[model samples]
Target: MDVPNKKTVLVIEDEIVLRDLIVKKLEEIGLGTLVADSAQEGEKLIKEKHPNLVLLDIMLPGGMNGFDLLERLKRDPILKSTPVIILTNLSTEDKTATEIGAIDYIIKSNISLDEVALKVKNHLQ
Candidate 1:
């Protein structure tokens, strides 16, 4: 595919390797990317940069988990409408993800990098 325009995506992931991989893929496809090692980091970027979308992980380090971050985003009228997609190995909380307005709950363990990029791009569009 041709490189996408400057659609920015915030990736909130704890695993360094996975986070880098996702960022690389997003960049390769021409989507501007931001990396946040935890939900707190993601939130800070959201407030400061306000990316077009976010790929959020369910489990994260620090007091602010992904769901906690989602709750915060939902409460903030300014960011409540920002699109969020849940990309996590934990599927047990799919219900909560849906209830909290995640555009999609992706299981990383069973998906390919290309597919992940495709899904993210689709939502960002």
Candidate 2:
């Protein structure tokens, strides 16, 4: 059963440890979460769930990287408005990610789990 008025965040990250930690922190803050290990899975979840926001990672295992997904999302009429935050290790791609339509770029190593959750909360509000 879905909870009424609850905001859901979709996290597209392949790292098991980081993904689990992100989900844990989000849950602790009373937000609903859906996780995907790849850009393909993330796209499917975004289409099906219509999450309020997305925490996307750049280095996915599948053929499509985060940039590809972000490009596709921005191009899609229905999904273009969805907020996406790029969470990855690549600091050099920040400009590219913003240009591609990610609302924010977070370098994974520079931020804490609490900060990530806080950012997500702020975006949802």
Among these predictions, the greatest TM-score belongs to 2
Per-candidate Cα lDDT values, in order, are 0.87, 0.92
RMSD of each: 2.9, 1.3
Predicted structure 1, TM vs. truth: 0.93
Q: Which stretches of candidate 2 lie over 4 Å from their true place?
A: 1-4
- Which candidate has the top score in lDDT? 2
118, model 2: CA deviation in Å?
Answer: 1.0
Model 2, 1-125: lDDT tens per residue? 12457898999999999999999999888988899999999999999999999999998997999999999999999999999999979789999999999989899999999999988898888
Estimate, for each residue in 48-83, the C-alpha lDDT of model 1 and write its tens digit.
888888999988989888989998999999999989
What TM-score quantifies how close candidate 2 is to the native fold?
0.96
Task: Name the lDDT value of residue 56 in candidate 2.
Answer: 96
